[model samples]
Target: MKNLTKKIRSKKLESKVDLTAMVSVSFLLIVFFMVTIDLAKPKGIGLGLPDKNPEWDGKIVCGMGMGDRLVTILLDDNNKLVSYQGLLSYPNEKPKTLSYDANGIRKELHNKKRLIQEYYGDTSRGPIVIIKPSKKCNYKNLIDILDEMAVAKIDTYSIINDFTPEESQLLAAN
Candidate 1:
């Protein structure tokens, strides 16, 4: 009779779930994805172009000569580039074929920039570069030369499409 009177005890079960760890893991995944998305964005190069309609008084502002301050870079096909200092007609340095490596066009640009700065005795006044891309060269070549301009930290530069007869012949010869 006493055993029959004893009620059956049920085992206690834990129904509460600890969601703190799950929440932490979710936040960590969100942060990781956010960081990776930001890193996947594309980078761009800043290019500043001159205005087409410029206000000019038809008068020479300064009488200073540009003979020693000019450096011309001609882009050709097959990853070949030709560089010469000063005017093409009367070049201070003859045109020479150069590569895009550290010891090639890059070195030439650094040396020429230094020489021009020393010649003028002014750090603000840097070399004036004229970049001419031939028909044989591709858009990548032009971009590469522009990149070199930025790498060399040149201040004054111009991309002129019109090439004189002598300049055309010079590129062909090289």
Candidate 2:
């Protein structure tokens, strides 16, 4: 009976040691995760994301690292796509006018489409149009440009804020 009692005591001791090892492992894992975790908030293009219901398709899509195939449309202080160029030549010059003319937009779109087809052989994957409009741009000009985009059938579009956070804050404070 003494031997039986001793054997039971040894089994209990082994179980306790196993529990201690498991606890130690768990603590180490927790510490490792805490130290290596990334907690920085993600920064985006500052546009508000629409609600997640899939039925709402007007949400402006965002993408990073678009190559030379992108097409950029700039709306100046007057809200016009005055300068239409391939992705490489963006920000080179101010776009020309505020007048609402679909003919010019269609022509530029067709030209860009031809260029893409001639160079890369895939005109179906149309260029991604990034519209950078000035804050004071009129609403009518914006609507006209959007209508032109739709007519041109260039669907991937992004409207970016012209000001950085600091500039925006300064403007707001003023």
In TM-score terms, which candidate is top? 1
Provide the lDDT at 130 for model 1.
90
List the candidate 2 regions with Cα displacement exceeding 4 Å: 1-67, 77-80, 84-99, 163-174
Model 1: residue 78 alpha-carbon error in angstroms:
1.1
Highest lDDT against the true fold, candidate:
1
Lowest summed lDDT over 10 consecutive residues: which window, candidate 2? 46-55
TM-score of 1: 0.63
Instruction: State in Å the error of residue 71, model 2.
Output: 2.3
Q: How much lDDT does candidate 1 score?
A: 0.82
